[model samples]
Target: MREGSPGWARLALLALLGSILVPLVAAGLRSVLWALVGIAGLALAAVGVWWTLAHTGVVRAFGVALTVTAPVAVLALYATFGMLWPALLSLALWVLALTAARTASTRGRTASGQAVAEAPHAPWVLMNPRSGGGKVGRFHLVEKARAAGCRVVLLDGSQDVTELARRAVAEGADLLAVAGGDGTQALVAEVAAHHDLPFVVIPVGTRNHFALDLGLDRDDPTAALQALSDAVELRVDLGYAADRVFVNNASFGAYASVVADPAYRDAKAQTVLKALPGLLTDEDAPRLRLRAARTSAEGLQALLVSNNPYGRAVDAGHPGRRERLDSGQLGVVCVRVDNAAQAARLVRGPRSPGLIRLSAEEVVVEADTATLPVGIDGEHAALPTPVVCRSAPAALRVRVPRRRPGTRRRPGTSRASGAAADWPRVTRLALGPLLRQRHQARAGASGSDSGSGSGSGSGSER
Candidate 1:
């Protein structure tokens, strides 16, 4: 119950209620038990306001810091649900009622729970209207902001998000929100930095990749809006490629070329038709020597820099992490492969080999024979010569809904794993020992630098 785990106590209560044939004495005993539960629930609620980390530590902070609003939230959810269905109580209400009545007197401690001050105010809303199936505009977010006593300005179309954000600050707008894609999310973040404003992110596009990383709601506009109410600001890291700020990832080699092509987008059939075989099996496709950041630089095939280091055995997309927004370092991943057989080996999934992951503050990328096509987040920009990417100072503040119990976040796949086997390895190169001096470790190859790091929180650095 403390973990918000679904248990059988509620089922037992339901059985008793469903059968009115139960004797009056038995019903009275059931009522007492329910009352005890109510007490425990309320006690936990009170403790939450003081508990900094609810879902971790000795019990593992199971929820986000925003859990301080638990009392109001739980009641709101139940009242809303009960209006729709009377049985909603028999299911979700009884459990909560018991907690509220039984645990109303508990005391707790704090984990940096400070009330916000009015002076020096700067607020931001980083909205990805193009996320989560592009349903953001329907959330009526504008009204919600006004209710909170904040100025509201919506960014849409091809407007320069960063510049608009700057102007918003000039116009005395302390808070900003962009209704758009993750690419747009990054742009808004860059502007927020100019004003030193705390950004609140609204996920309204497909995937909501960055939203997921920040433990925010990809759905539920109300909860996302509510999260911005008592915003307890935290600074995460930002990645930079030249002048631009990327919140999630950066990629080089074929990824840049693929995403840059207008014809390759959204149309899965066409993307596969053109990208596959053309990259892996085609002899005419371009290649490059790879070098992973903060590791022994290698003249392998491809290169990638992530927002954070990935875990071994974790899929490129599912790097299980504790802090996706820690602002200090970056993650670099790379793979080396030469032919199709090795490509097939890497394609087997889960066991992709020769995968190297590195953590560093910065890295340098260059090409020998040709200019490298780089994808900075999802937006394709001109190829910079000898691109130098580094972790930017502090982090762009964005608001996201807290994580819910048992939500299903799908794991990300490497380029090869996501697509055809034709182009498995990045290119031909030599693997060298890292700074400590280690030899080559041999195995298969895959989309080592396929920008899985972007999913973490840092946008593409390319």
Candidate 2:
């Protein structure tokens, strides 16, 4: 609109460039990603060819490199080398950046290349007073968040979070952020969905499981804060049990019992440690019959489910071991072990083995014998058995760093680095129990009306 002013021209150039280039960029980058991925496949294929040629002994040990003619010895023949294709996506991005930059707009001006500051509206910051050795006290994360356009609020032991969040949403807030445990994370998510605002998850609690999944840095609140300004809003699917929302998953049976134990609050570490000896030593733990809605099922000693089927287990199943957050499915994992002896034998150390695993849209679980306590997304709850599990189908919107396609590394090389997604700005309203009931009533009334021959209000009498 302006005559060659760098600001307006650049804006116009970017708008035009984005419109013309995004698809082309998407297509081109996709090709590069697939190309690098394909190269990786070729490399693996070449290895597989070599592995096939080598029947055994020393020949089996060495393999030929696909990209290079140089022969590799058995030292290089790792099964994991093939999986590097996906990981190599990071390399493909730099190539893409160069290519995209080469195709210039007629305006010929490059992006300002400066990462913009992320200032979220209505940020709800909740901290856990009891988490990870009280690390929040050591770090002034709240003050830092306040400095970065965040409306900071503290969580006093999960007291009235839904209420506090509901109030924030009512006051025209656009983001709900939590710096606490998974329990607090899910609670904040509930209010975020209630108001339909973007929820920022700052992992201050123990493990920071979901944080790792989103490629966020738990140790650095600034990186998490940068996520507010740096990444796009992904409408991630949330798992629901009863009235609560779960970014992780829900399980009934073994872990449920452990979580439900009142002493678990105090003896979580000790109890787990004590239980580990028996679980590893003995091969017997309580065997529970498992059933899902209208599906053939098996018996499990301890059943655990994640929002997404977790990635290959590492770090005793905590920390680095995180599930795919955007799979649009819930992961169901079932295990069988009875008695302390059997549990010891069946349980695989701290990180449990994934068994009877599958991604299902919905699951209805019930047991034949005793009622089961349930653990939903690392939070405890009680159900009378026959618990229902289903995907919420894009219910929660979260802010996560925009990663370059085909790689796990954060986008830093291109102008698009730290570019958050432009989310659809929507109004947030915490649907009160009364309002929720009214909404249900309206639906019922509408259903009844639809069942009958209904006309316009006044004219219906005729």
Candidate 3:
């Protein structure tokens, strides 16, 4: 069926209803009870996993055992009761329904942008050969950029990037661009913003989160080169943590501590897993208090402040992705899972008190300690407390290719802010056309009756 059509909407609504009802109809009331039990078990298992990270010795072993056995026990209960098939079917239908609902609601949505008439006369591009496993060398970006009438600077790890950007600006560079990670991107972007020059992004970074949000093709770094000839300028916001600018986000608490570890660069996952326990349990560790937009939160274990609010739909294939960069607001997510019960409650998603998600124009992060370890766009740094993170609305002008992959919203994607579905909005969208048609039919009938009565009266008078 065609997307955004009445039929598609009806199908989505039906699928959503069926995802809940099918289990009950097939397996009776026992299925409902079993499902609740399963959810609780899974929540407990999550708590157990946290325990395994935060504890050592016998308690850790118990946590490991519980984590392994809880889900298995739930499965065993389902198998014993002959409800496994129905449970699996319900889950599959739920996923399908979510996908259909998201598509029906968010179709035809696009980011706000304006056309750029003039191209930069003197563009300077920086290429980091080691950024994404030597993407510059593989793509031959330096040669391509120079051939396109732009001056190219290849970074060799010695010279500071910010200084390089300033030097380029002094030498009459009209546009500044980077072919590196978000940290490097932020540096050049800041320089470009300071000089009021257009900034371009080449998605040569391993995970170009900034480029992805701008709708640039991450797979093809060369595609970004088209911005020089044919482009649109997007006035996007930049995030600042104190004086430092971040293109993506500033992370504090547990995550920042992990990033500051010496072993993180060589072994990231292992480092995080090893560090989480100590960070979570250390009482003397600096407790953070966050204040923003008339709301305040304290005792936060982890906090993430982003340049723009990220899309909330976890299943939309783009978690931690921002739909628009021009919102002029910072996305703040604070986590404070203090105990097993709090960890278990996370199954409620956004409703859980353990997680606080909000948006504000500015945020102040104060800690009990004199200094706070922060991860700014994946780079680690130490900042003095009460660190201030604020949005620099329309501070940087970004020139992107007029035609790129991310410019259009893909089907099955959502712009929702969190994991929870906005069912009310979905319902309205799903039933809107049908409701309008019904109202029109009733109005037509009323008009026909009025006309008929008037005709009879005129006949009698004649």
Candidate 4:
């Protein structure tokens, strides 16, 4: 069974209980010994890596030393842990289970490739050479685009991307593609939507969250080039906060403040730590008024509005993945507390008491200041107070590779939700009839045996 299924969950619970109880009843010392051995193996591996990297001895001699001993040490540790077969078996089984889950989840939903290899018009690709540390140049994206018959435009930071996209569309570019960060993707996607051109995402960004959600292979930008040949067009929603468009999410309050910090990009942890003390402790922190659904809150320290709702469970396979992109609603999360303790608790569990999370077609955030600092798709901006966020459902048409690497559903799509909701019924329908037949057969057999015994007894009396 796939992970998180009822069968798998039951087995996991049993294993966990057995692990705790069986040790107490028997071989307690052996379990402790195995734990120690595993810890020792990890420590030894760390030491090996450090020694091989940090030692300043004779170069060739050090290489020889590491080359000779590292494998031996690893093998020794493996042998100490019962010949390593069990570990290998466990790893193989884990891989098999993961593959099964992915396959089961994507059975009939994933797009398939057809051998057409045609484009309506030459595609214009907007590439930011500076995005993801010059990923375009590093990956030879221009050469690849040329090979794919795409007209490539290098964004030199001089021209407005929106205008550039407009010009491309005017000049007979039927399809729009971007090889840049989410910020650039949003700008180009907006233009694509306005022109009714199919959009393609080349994930050359630091996060590429939008691309990831689209089920594109974020690891390899070249993989997306295949969409030009064999593609599947999917209609997805876009999120707008004020005049700005965001592909992933927009953030207000704490996250916005942190991203707006001058040193945040280079020193994220330090910047957050420095900003947290004042943000949490200041009683005069600007309170944000939020109205969504039937919930109204004032003085919320932070607000996050996503294009689609993220899964509620922290341990879900894909925690922040949108089940479907055309959900037609904005996922809003409100943080009511301004204290560090509350923040810590939230990190410990997403279901912490002070968090109010919900999905809505629109969310309005009012602030005391004339302008509120907001982080839109990881880029910081200042928007006028009373910021209105809304979902533009099916606003953009995205061209993705046929047989996309990881095809999954978005949050609010009724079909996906209905499938999940109807799983219990489906399972019962498949098994319930067989169970009833078995019970009837067993009961009939018992009745037949009783009748046969009564006849035998009557015959004996005669």
Candidate 5:
């Protein structure tokens, strides 16, 4: 209708129909029962996996067995019933339908933005040479920035980035830009915001979450440099934990604890696997109490406070991405799954009691311990109890290329996150055009009748 894609909606509906019909057609009515069993088994497998991560000894071994067997059992049943192909095909179609539905729903949506007329006169850029496995050197970002008439400073991991930004500002730098990870981006962004200067982002980091949210091209770091010539300024919010700034998010409890381990940097997967059982089950583990506007959650095993709320569905392209950075609210996701039952309930999606998602202007996290370990933008820290995480609404002026891949504002195009699709919403959107047309026809008929009545009254008066 007014927005989204009708073509994609048709495709999504077709795929959805196929997802259901394929299994039924191939394996008859019994396939429905088999499908239900498969779903239950998957849910059980999820619970089992959670158990293995959160328990030790016999319980952990049993969880491992359950995790391995549940999915295998489902497959075995499908194979024995000669419904394996149909089941797999149905699952694939369902996934495709969901993806198409998301695209259809989000299509044609564009973000409101402000255009910049003039470029910065004296823009200063900071590049971390080692970031993204030396992306700066690999792309020759330093030389390219200088070529674009920017004063460049290459970070050697020795100097304070905040001080560098401050020095640049003191020396009459008009704009601040960074070609590094989110942690470094936060450091410079704070300085830029303090000075009320425009900040630029070059997505040369291992994971440029901020850049992606801003609709910048993460694959082409050099494309961001074009902003110096033609730019659009977006006033976005920044996340803060106490006095520290975080462009992405501040993590507490399980994730923070994992990052705090000295061995994490060397062997991340091994470290997380080794530490999960203790962190998830230990009674002595730091329990966090989180308070936000109109809501409070206690005894959270892990909590993430982001600059803006992340979409419920994970984006196949960019996992854990926020739909908008300018929401002026902190996104809070609290997890407290303590048992297999609670873990199994996760199949209910966002409605599960074990998982909580909300948004607030501010959040306060309190812990029994005097200091709590935190992971701010993937960097570990220890913050005092009663840590305050707040959103600074429209605090940073982010300069981005006017023409970027992720921000093309056109019909059948959108800046919205292609995360998980909401099926109900998608269904409504698919029917929107017909609904609008019917309403319009009724309104027009009513208007005509009113007009005729008015004309008759005028003639009678005359």
Candidate 6:
């Protein structure tokens, strides 16, 4: 169906409404008895884990028994409710809801304020052959970059990245690029910013969070190479912990401790599981002490300081994504739970009361130890106590491809037929028909002003 047609609009409205209600309806249709049983089962499991951790003799024995029984209770509830179809249907409905919400949200969004410039005549790209399971070799990024008129530098074990980037700029390379993780990106971006050159990102690394926020195609490293020819540069903020630059975030406390482990890369999940419980429960005073204008806390389990704030709520639409990278404030989340009970409650619910969230231009942290381990954009390092962190506003000029995935509509454009492009917007769109109906009713009743009312109402309705 044609997008502007009445039939198409009506269909879109219905689809949007269905997407909004189906998940709620499916959840409501679930058996309340079985639901309560499921909750009990979860609570029991959590209690068991907590007790085991506490290690009181009788409590530990009971905890083991409860842990063993919790799974049986869950399986029994599944069988009682005939959960197979309902489980599958619930998953499908949730997925549909997310899709609709994403579609609706992106419609109202616009592209970042980016300057149009000529692509550099002489571009230099630094690549890590070992990043992302050797994505450089698998994707043939070096060959692709060279073909795109880039001078490629393979990052072997010998050379320092910052010095290499500095050398490239000094050698008259007009543009600098990195095909690795955020750590390498930060190194090269720092040099590029110092030299006032635009930087390009080729996301050939594990969890390219910075590239994802840039709206680049993380799945295709080759598509990122297109930036060498397309000169769309966005001015974004950069975060600094002392002299070190981090593109995404720098983490302190428990997570830092975990990442600092020499064997963490070999067994990430296991290492975290083993390290986290002790990190949270140990009575020794927390090494990291945090202080900001709006907050003061000690013994924080972890603190995350990001270049830009992530969305506060964990809903399907945004899913911890930062809406804008240009915000001149750092996003901070601090977690401090004194006991296992608090941690269990946190895991069982949406958010813990213990979470301290804030945005600030600067934050100061003092560690009890002489040196503190910090995780900077996934790379680990040890920095001295009393670390000072700050946000540098509009510090970097990052060049992206002209035609890239997840590109938003520009502001001040006509939104007459703007349908939702992101899932959260779908929820808003689902409410539109009812709002329009109310407005029409009001317009009809107020006969003298009906013309203006109806005309104004119709514009948003469309």
Which predicted model would earn the best TM-score?
A: 3
Best by lDDT: 5
Ordering by lDDT: 5, 3, 6, 4, 2, 1
What would you estimate as the lDDT of candidate 6? Answer: 0.73
Query: What's model 2's overall lDDT?
Result: 0.55
Query: Local error of candidate 1 at 55, Å?
Result: 48
Q: Which residue segments of model 2 deviate by more than 4 Å?
A: 1-119, 269-287, 292-295, 313-323, 338-354, 369-371, 402-462
Residues 1-462, candidate 2: write the lDDT tens digits.
Answer: 111122322333344344444334435555445444444544454444334232233433443233143223221432134423332343354334322322221111111123334656556666665666776677777678778777777666646877888888878887888888777788789888766788777777787766666656677644666667776666667777655577776767666767776778888965654453343224454445544444445556566666655543223534333324555667666754333233333334324332465567777676664555778767778776566677776677777655422124322211222221111110011123346889999999989888664556557676
Q: Give a tens-digit lDDT track for model 5, residues 321-350.
A: 666677788988898888788888887778
lDDT of 4: 0.71
**Count of backbone clashes, every candidate in sequence:** 67, 27, 3, 6, 0, 16
Which residue ranges in model 1 land beyond 4 Å of their true spot?
A: 1-131, 290-301, 312-322, 344-353, 398-462
Where does model 3 exceed 4 Å of error?
1-9, 107-110, 313-319, 408-420
lDDT of each: 0.51, 0.55, 0.84, 0.71, 0.85, 0.73
Alpha-carbon TM-score of each model against the true structure:
0.57, 0.56, 0.92, 0.69, 0.89, 0.76
Query: In candidate 1, what are the lDDT values of residues 1-462, reduced to their tens digit?
Result: 021112322332344354332322334445445434434445454344223221224322422233345445555644553321333334454444333222221111111122344422444454445455556557766666567655665545566667767877887767666556667877878777766776766666665556555555556655556545544444566787767677777777666767777876768445644564355335665555443353564444556666654333235564323233453677676655454334334433335564455668887776664456777777887665667778874656544333331123221111111121111111110111131233222211123334454555465543
- Candidate numbers sorted by TM-score from highest down: 3, 5, 6, 4, 1, 2
Runs in model 5 deviating more than 4 A are 26-29, 57-62, 107-111, 313-317, 408-424, 438-462
lDDT of 3 by residue, 1-462 (tens): 123444545667788788789888977777678889889888979888878877777888888999999999998888887888888888888877776665555433224567889888999999999999999999999999998889999899999999999999999999999999999999999999998999999999988988877878899999999999999887889999999999889999998999999999999878987888778887776568999988999999999999887766133456557756877899998988878889899888888998899999999999988899999999999999999999999999999898888745452122422223445667887788778999999999999999999999999999
Q: Worst lDDT window (10 residues) for model 3?
A: 411-420
Q: After superposition, how far is residue 160 of candidate 2 from its true place, in Å?
A: 2.2
lDDT of 4 by residue, 1-462 (tens): 112234432333344344445433444456566445544544444343333332334632454465566556655765675535544444454444433333223212212223345665689999999999989988899999989999999999898999999999989999999999999999999999988888999999988878877778777999999889888787888999998999988999887988999999899977875676467446776778998878788888888998877544232344445555776888887776543344334533446766777899989999989999999998899999899999998899888877666654322121222121223333444355668999999999999999999999999999
Query: What is candidate 6's lDDT per residue for 1-462, written digit by digit as tens?
Result: 111223333344565455445444655644555556666777678767666644456866887788889968687667665664554454465555444443344322222455555678899999999999999999998888898889999999689999999888889899999999899999899998888888999999888878877777888988988777755777888999988899888999988989999879999977876676667676774556888887888878789888877654323444325656777888888876666567456544435665777889999988778888899999998888888889998899888887777564323111222222333334345556668999998877788587778899999999
